[model samples]
Target: MNITHRVSLLCAALPLLSGCALVVNAAPASTATAAPVFEQWRETQHRGGDDLMTAGLGLEGLRASVAPVFSSPALPTADEARRRAIWSSWRGIADLTPGGGFGDRYGSVQSAPGREFSAYARIPGARHPHRVLVQIPDNFDPARRCLVATASSGSRGIYGAIPVAGSWGLAHGCAVAFTDKGAGSDYYDLDAKSGFQADGTPATHGALAFVPEAGTAAHGVAFKHAHSGDNPEADWGRHLVQAVQFGLQALDRAYPQSAPFTSANTRTLGVGVSNGGGAVLRAAEIEGDWFDAMVAGEPNVSIAGAPPLYDFVTQAALLMPCALLAIDDLPQPPVQAQARPLWTQQCAALKANGLVQGDDTDAQAQSARQQLANAGLSDGALRAGAFSTGFDLWRAIAVTYASAYGGFAAGQHPCAYTFSAVGADGKPGAATPEARASWWSEASGIPPGSGVVLVDGNAAHVADDPLRGLRCLHALGTGDSAEAKRVRAGIAKAAANKPRAGLPIVVIHGIDDGLVPSSMTSDRYVPQARAAGAQIAYWRVTNAQHFDSLLAFPDYRKRYVPLLPYMFAAMDQVWAHLEDPTRGLPQDALIETTPRADAPLQPAQLSIPVVSSR
Candidate 1:
């Protein structure tokens, strides 16, 4: 069968083999009826009520259940004065200095029988302080050098690093370290009269701040200081790199005689997922000599690489409004009136412009084929499928856009433009007149009838037609303000993916990823990296979503839980290839894996036939 046909068949069987029910059931429970069986199982696990011992295995299950009851004794702590001196010794080091040379900066160090040494280091930066944790094996010896992996934490914060990759590094006899780059604590102190205010208050501590209103200077000030600011050099990515470097320094200082740690080797790797993944890739590109290999799963690398198509601010403006309307359970009449027309108009525009049409038409099928072809998925026999249909595209835009909006408007990082009419019961409700007026008046400057529409008050909200918003934002070009220009430049610099020559990098992404589209990697990063002469391997998993691995929901957990091992295995291969030139890394491969209830998950890999990119 041709590649197109193969892809179609894979797509058809995805729901069954890859657990489509999980995605279908991903939405919040609408009715009061108990959640699906899998969801219930997940809840049980969360509450510590599930009997793991009997659920999947026999003796092993019992051991798993009882294992946590036995607690290990705590290790001794290091002297506070000595720890301070150790860190003070390296106070003026440049942020990008590479390798392990300053481990003594760790404030606390304790060693267990098998776990060896676990230490925490606090590295202060201009914007915020970085907290890094390092783990060393009990058998660590100065004469025998070991691999060191600097892991980046995902969106949930620094605690997520060890579970994602650090534990695996430790098990493989590699020292593992991670830094919390102030994700949880980093914020602008709104009440601090000036940027230099020492109130120590976090940016997220109070009411949501305005983004960039013209007349409101307070809003602009908050926007400038918020975590996502106009300064690229001071952003989170820059801080992460510095933290990683500091963590490495602490490792070397702690083990000063350990082979005089110098260069990247099979023993030095960088690993992360999502935001963390992006950090890893950015660090590799900026500090090329620090790591021999890197593994980035669903890295957020397209903000700059893909240009107008994937910039975060543009995406928020274009997609979030429409998404908010679609998911609101009890939207007001005005909201529905505004949103429905916007959706219909955009769909009509798409059809009229030949961007989408009925799936049966030859022209439409060819168009669909061409688009997929760009992502290296065209097969002669494969016809334009559901995605090409105007109706399908409409539905997709609503669902995916809504999801994106929900994430963007989440309480953790609310923007001034993001407004939600959520009811006391935690469900979306109609907007009050006052709420509607607040946002509408502020947005009055938006061109009238230009896709951006205000629909309600008090609980009011804004809805932007997706396609129109995209075009409008693209035209805006990050606004005319100096700060806006800085923000744009910072994004471009941070998102650049120019890896140094000969570095082994493996990027793995799920084809169905909703948040950061998989094409960002398969179609953009891979080709760009190849063009740069970097030794890179790309793995495209059949059915996976952005939060699949991190969420405890049954379907998501099941589909992605088993894939971690394969990802690590791929990293190992990439590292090996860096060490041995003759060894080859797999490229354009399809990895299939099943989550096991009885044992550890394993993946079976297959080589995908090469196809020309459009």
Candidate 2:
């Protein structure tokens, strides 16, 4: 039997409502199913220098600032890139510091040797391929078959979920499947005219992971998410389902004794964070009986006509700096940026632009605060968002999403915001070949980091002032232009449909998650999910914000509980309920928690409760 055959081809939408309970197994895989998108795969083995979880970095090594070095920067072996990519991803998602739970408590820190298989999968009729990687842990037992399919958070590369879903699956001896969902840091350097291949080496010709159409690129870098010419976000869920199929097939290859691995013989789960979480939810809605359960943490879900992310992010980009100052005791204020006078500039700019009317900076801040609140953001979220705002993420996200939602080509970016390597002066320049070579390992999918910068072409005279570009992005969300219509149309396609009944779902989110704020996501979607009769369990943890790695900072540790531990805990709860109905899922309630402050996190601070679901 061919495992790819039963990959859950578009199920007939029964007139029933949203997501269901434990999914009953499907029929065995066969060739007579629908046509396949990922029937072929490339395989590799990771044992000594790198293993399944953390790439053999272990708890302490993962916390290290430095990653395994490439023997030659311009020509990294695929193995070298894989190891470093895992290292970067772990640091990106989890809080590996001594104070945060690296190994002592909740994290999946042990090394697990494995075989990996990858398929450059294309959605039907789509020209670009989303990269999918599936790891079959050496300890995977066909008799106790399980698979966890995850999508990468944000626009990060395939390894983006390494520390989140990857760790959990490998630790549980499950085949872990991951996809970049058509957006990754496997960048195409337009200047170099070469793009990184699946093997992590650059190629000027042939099928690269992402190569901007010839004569259709700006003089900088072009990443898949922003310039793929296809609105990939619309198909994030389909990519993940394909990833699950890829895993089942790879498992069959790894252990032929179990000739055809199917969902009937496996306990498959979908788990993701941020955008990954959104993808998991989308899959639950679209694919019937494909997954036994799902665990989503801080999903950046898009529901057209219901407070779109681009609108909020673009608005936050312009208003958050000034407005957050109105909130008292926000952690990590933009104090250092005072040298560039950013916060003051935002306040002054807002007042001058008629966006806010105030007699003083404080009054201007108050008006901006009121504007954001009126727009649907919670004060708690604004406080947490200030941290990311300080890091200048609001502008980066606004710039990236504007291109993605509009399907804007590399050269035709909204507001002429281009991505490229920049100098200390914040001026864009052709990236050095050496820098381009290491981008796959060093940079997150989004720019404004790892040598790549988001440069506003119009900000030549006033690099400190970002009003023009931001205003353009904001208008794309709220205005009525033809280009703006394109963005809105793309956004409409991203709105999630109801999940098929009987696939148990658990959504866990931090009340203070500013990156993908709950007020804009789970808070809005969960109620709708329940109203639609989806058997979903929602847990909103207090005192926890989005990013766990930020907890490494002393001030952050004192203010917020790490959301990862709770996410892992929720995964356990959902699994337990699936294994035995009597175990019951977690109650749909807010779980209280406390920050560790200066001390090590105690079990009591977590306040995780377990009881029969009511």
Candidate 3:
């Protein structure tokens, strides 16, 4: 039977098995205009009717609501059946490590005598194994099966899995499972090496490796490429797909029928934040049969293409530095003055390195070059001089951070300063191939023909507008080749497709999220799903930052922690709809809240307007 038919059958059977209330609400009707829905939702909220959470509730209120559900008794028949189904499909390719710990670490329940264990699943084509942490509840029953929530981590690695697993999965009486998804390091290592060898070379058994351009400063920072697996499995999309598929299989194997896991009664749910959020979405699209429900918070669904690359460079070179400097108590004027001279020097260095062939008159170009050279010493010398004299503290810190995160060496870093120039509109301008080349050469101090391969000029996409030119460098050999074709197909297969008819999906994003812009969801994903007639709910939270609520940012924690219970409760409602089809799909609306640390989660109404893709 088809997926929708199967889901309908399951829903129909649910009533017979447990007297479950099947609420068959009609699908949301299509509208010609979008603004009315937003207004209507606002009206509803203002009316003070029953929503997910009541108005004026505080932390104590949140705890009171959540405690009971988590502490409830098990459904033995359902749990046992679910556990059995999971093990029946197990591949047994993973090894389970015993767990012993206490208290909360990274948001997971601290188990004394360790209820949590690590299962390492070996990927068929990759060198590194995928790691899944399974946290079993205290009240374990061998005869009962439990719900499973598989969480994926963000770019920062498995630490991103803690908040959701703790607040949502564990608290909801479900077994919380998390995967490293192959990128196990704290940072995205361009070099395959993550775990170090005693002899100092990258350990041969590290994550898969991706090839980097030889002449770039980003090269040789590590021992191996963790993303480059054998051929078709090399890309991240396929890795995540494998991680989810085998992660479940491994879990079934680890908790056998004789133990507490019975797949027959179990239902799988997927949840993730940031990159992990993207993984869950992709997994649902690729393997809808595997997951009954999913929640993705601020998922990075789009690839690292031209637009994102541009944003990445601009944020690193201009936006981030300014923010960091401000936090350091540096005045804007002096910092701007320091930055201008540094930018000029970088432009001159690029010209000198034969990277920029001046198209202007020889005299004009020469005068411009002289003017820039005379502005001040290069950024590297300035930073060194500042550190030595204890001057320009903000610039020093800004440059250091920019270099570290932008994947370049500190001092005379090209990528850090190459795109710092402002255009007529006062935004950062794009760096040309020659400029990028100059920056790389200066940073590495390597000559043009000295065995280092430089990026081709064509690869540096030039646009009429400098802002348009801002893009991250694309992966080498990402087009037309056999491997490239395979990677593209894999990514397309795993991307969020037109949602299925009955499967309910709730996507929550922060309006003020700096990392993955909310527009990607509100503008792209939601509209596509809506157009395709999928049961989708999109929540745009006002004034919420990307990492807020999930991470321990003191300001965000105060404002966002109280909202977690409500958010999870909404998700639970969606899951209920999946099983009974009576709970109705969640309404798409804007979640409004004051920025105050003590403010409650007061969701106002706003509809996602359908806009044509840019």
Candidate 4:
């Protein structure tokens, strides 16, 4: 399919549902009409609505003029200090550093026979007691070597996902070390603050803080359009670095207490999805020497890499209010130079395809003019008034204009833009057209990427939209056009700053992911790692979504277990090459297995545990 056609197909797949559900498959089915596993999966999804509510999602009844925003404070209280202390203590024991080389250490948690366990770590500046969740393996081994994994986010404590999976890892003779990043879960709370401020000032805790303008085009597009201000890329990157560093300290402690110390090699790899995937990149950058390899599943490396249509919509939101309403629009050059490439390419493509015309013959152009008429603007007015002021009004007006011209608002009515055929005539489809219409808004000044479509507020929430906008603007550093360049430059700088001399890093992203785009992985991360001469693997799954590809194993627990060996084995090979550069990238390190989490863990029972140290 063509780029626009492919883009439309991808957009159609982005349905928003709050909860996640898993479906397990039966051993064998002989029935003529056995339900597809995903069909069963949907049942679980339907039942999960309640869980989503508790997780603070999908409250459709609630209305807001704007989203809530926040900022991060220093690890404020003594209680916070106490928690850090606990984390530090556990980290110290898990350290596996070698021969007094503090930087070379790693961490591991192993279960002993009889459900007893030995936890080792190396905590820096040893000071306080820690509360750690140690999983004791039923079948512990002193003879077999182990593999260790560090989680990306510490906002949530170490007890959840990693611990559960690590438990299984221990059963198979691999030890695991998880880092809480001293934030200890509660990711939502931390992100909420970092995305905004308490008193409603823009905070410096988010990705936008690193950018120059400090709330310009990027944040504006994000807040007004997407209804989400979470900058998972930078937030997760920070957490990943902290986690890996702490995890290394934990690994160092594991040695000396155990055998052959420095000579013995146990593989280490970083893995995560979405934000977690972004974390893998951060960890690879900071803890390059610690791991043999890393896997990033569907991470968006640069904000600009997201689809262009979204950006245009956000631009419209910002420009419309200021130009048409005289509210002071963001300055010119649109977004940063980095953002311009994709937008330019797409715009050119659209124009070339005749979907968007450069002249008056353009249907979109004709509709746009009609939309202007509905918004109470005449040709003289269009020529006289600024475009930024009343941009949203103009957008609404445009839809009315389109309707008056027998066209429907892009998203609201399907019939207006609908047609049969797969070529340019109807090729991009209704969704793409909607995205384009939204892009018109983003092209102006509206928040293009914000996920919140509609919001409501009470008397107390009177400042809701403004406050939310302020927080988003501040958090994303999106006060003006200069800010857009700043955001893009920051990502480039971060990518440039890192040197890659150790380990193989492979980033895999699904093209259709609604949360994070695959382009970020392919465009920014792959290039950065490749420039450093790091062994880099960048894979794009055609139609995969966020984390759906990660946790979808058929038998989940049972089937995924076997792949652990192959994954770790790849790490071992990569580590060998890292230790000895003359050896080059390992040939056998590439192992293809099921890409989805739903694949079954095959060959159920095993009496032997194969442990390899290179």
lDDT by residue for model 4 (499-570), tens: 356556755544443333344344566766677787676554332333221222232222212222222333
**Ranking of predictions according to TM-score:** 2, 1, 3, 4
The residue-by-residue lDDT of candidate 2 on 467-526, one tens digit each, is 777788899988899989989888898888777776778888989888888888888887
TM per model?
0.51, 0.92, 0.49, 0.39
lDDT for 295 in candidate 3 is 76
lDDT by residue (376-429, candidate 1, tens digit) is 332311111111121222222222222232222212221222223433464433
Scanning candidate 4 in windows of ten residues, the lowest lDDT window is 35-44
RMSD of 2: 6.5
The 10-residue segment with the lowest total lDDT in model 3: 34-43
Writing each residue's lDDT as its tens digit, candidate 3 over 1-614 gives: 11111112332333123222122233321321110000000001111211111111222222231221111122122222212212211101000111100111112222211134333433443333444445545443434444445444433232235545434555555555665555432111223322321111122254322222323344222211122232211233333443344333323433544422323345666776666667666555543355566777777665322233222223233223222222222222334466644544433433444433453334333443343223322222222122212223222222222232233321123322321222235443332222221221111111111121222223243332221211212121134544334334444433455555555677887665544555534347777767777667787776555533222223333333222332454566666665666446677777655543333222321222221221
Off by over 4 Å in 1: 1-126, 151-154, 185-225, 228-244, 256-260, 264-266, 303-305, 308-486, 554-563, 575-583, 592-614
Worst 10 residues of 1 by lDDT: 38-47
User: Candidate 3, which segments miss by more than 4 Å at Cα?
Assistant: 1-114, 122-124, 141-144, 186-264, 303-495, 549-567, 576-581, 598-614
Say which prediction, candidate 1 or candidate 2, comes out ahead on TM-score.
2
lDDT-based ranking: 2, 1, 3, 4
- After superposition, candidate 4 runs with Cα above 4 Å error: 1-144, 152-168, 182-184, 187-256, 259-266, 303-477, 481-499, 549-614
Task: Name the better of 2 and 3 by lDDT.
Answer: 2
